[model samples]
Target: MNSQSPQTVLSGLRPTGRVHLGNYFGAVRNWVRLQEKYRCLYFVADWHALTSDYADPSKIRQATFDAVADWIAAGLDPKRSTIFLQSEVKEHAELHLLLSMITPIPWLERVPSFKDQQQELKDRDLNTFGFLGYPLLQTADVIIYRAHFVPVGEDQASHLELSREIVRRFNNFYGNVFPEPQPLFTETPKVPGLDGRKMSKSYGNTIPLTASADEIRALVMTMFTDPNRIRRQDPGNPDICNLFQFHKLFSDDATIARVDRECRTAQIGCVDDKKLLAEIMVENLRQIRARREEIDRDPSIVWDALREGNRIARQHASETLELVRKAMKIDFPELR
Candidate 1:
């Protein structure tokens, strides 16, 4: 990635499905805030989605809309950020092809997530060129925006390292057109699902951001609480309760303290505690739902925004690609 002020940041999400509360607090909130301080490029990673779940991919189109809609509603300002789609810009694929030539096979083979996901999705046949080359595409996505920083969790640090190494190799051969991007680590909270597990769609344990008030209420009703406090009269352990964790995020600090005090003393019953959490969740979601409805009504707004973004992305990426072709001696004199 090329960095102008050395503060440009790029990151993206695959258009998989409806984002959940976990997604909101974990990644989207950070992107929303980072846009104010940094040069930001946020893209819908529709191409990356094909790495694993290429089969039955008709959902990608709908999922992309839902994901982008949620991003706009969650305060990602398009005026300050370059929001684009990966497939819309052909330069990304061109850069990916170029980077793949320089990227060693062992480098891609050693990507931890690649192998882990291959085994995890063993039911599907993973023997494909696209599956192995997705990380190279990821590198292209980051560098095309000339991003100096990539916000990621601890687990993703290795991929950033690999991208840095690829950048070094490319610069060694070609002229210096890209910078080695670094990780901007974020401390994402442990958001548990209704099943007392990590919130994930695969586990059928996500609370959808667009879930109706009644649906959220029903899910909250089934939320797991302290197992030791089976009886309403029994003293509960808020420390061990997932709903308590949620309360800490959604409820006022004073209410959280009271919930802690009352629960440990057997004053607040589990049912009432869950009901209170449900109310807070519903209240917070009301504005998000309204924002989404407004955006949905004018579907052209998203398309128009994306079209403008594609224009910006193509211009920026073409500049880099032109320099790359010159460095690699691919551009002809007549073409130039």
Candidate 2:
């Protein structure tokens, strides 16, 4: 916390199942780029995951390994970025508890996503204390390290405002023990699933980064396109087709241009476009699979990286807690 830089970047992801294409384009891919220029801290948010999946936690350990493996596969160099497990660092929990005491109840209740998720995930009883307090935990995750930037997409930038507000309020009461984290807006693409929905594991529509070429091909074949193009001869509106969006991201300029023109002119049928995208997708993802296989061969690489990062993070976090405790007159020197 003492060496806090204006360039320090902090972000994290939940330990869900396999890392998917949606997860790649949405966060990890951008994180890969961030590590090159900033002192980045990217962690597996296992403690945060408890907010919802507390009832069934059997998959969390495997999920954490899979998340770390996929992050490495997607080019997060442990040598460059600090990669740690959230639960391994006790300071995060302590900071969250301290912040909660000062953060107003109305402030947490007013977070837009708080109510949105509750209404959406009605199947799960989210009335627990953790569900409402995760945002505060998120704020603790950022300002505890006095992070300067949190990489998020443009639309989601407003979400950081809540964390910023908490930081301002906390610094006001506790002295400038933290820095308000700002959103480093990144280019996040909208990755749709095979069924034309947002690509999500919840929808059973995610293409995991570790998916085989054959599996990708099969998924691509099922990809939804313009419903208006009901026939092979029907000239499709590439503008309205999600598969064309895939072409833009995965295919080269010439191929993307060709697909755009051919689909418009009815020269390329849906099947042919799917085949082309499948091959291009598989080719682009080949290196990632190879890297994942190599990393998984020595499972110690993933765990070792976390071990070293946890050590480093623990040192910084302990120092930050000391500053926090002193600012609030809570560091009991007698106990030490």
Q: Where is model 2 more than 4 Å wrong at Cα?
A: 1-6
Backbone clashes per model, in order? 3, 0
Q: In model 1, which range of ten residues has the least summed lDDT?
A: 1-10
Angstrom error of the Cα, residue 30, model 1: value is: 0.8
Model 1 vs. true fold: TM: 0.94
| Residue ranges of candidate 1 with Cα displaced over 4 Å | 1-6
Query: Pick by TM-score: which candidate is best?
Result: 2
TM-score for model 2? 0.97
After TM-score superposition, what is the CA distance of residue 184 in candidate 2 from its true location, in Å?
Answer: 0.4
Each candidate structure's TM-score, on Cα atoms with residue i matched to residue i, is 0.94, 0.97
Evaluate residue 227 in candidate 2 and report its C-alpha lDDT on the 0 to 100 scale: 90
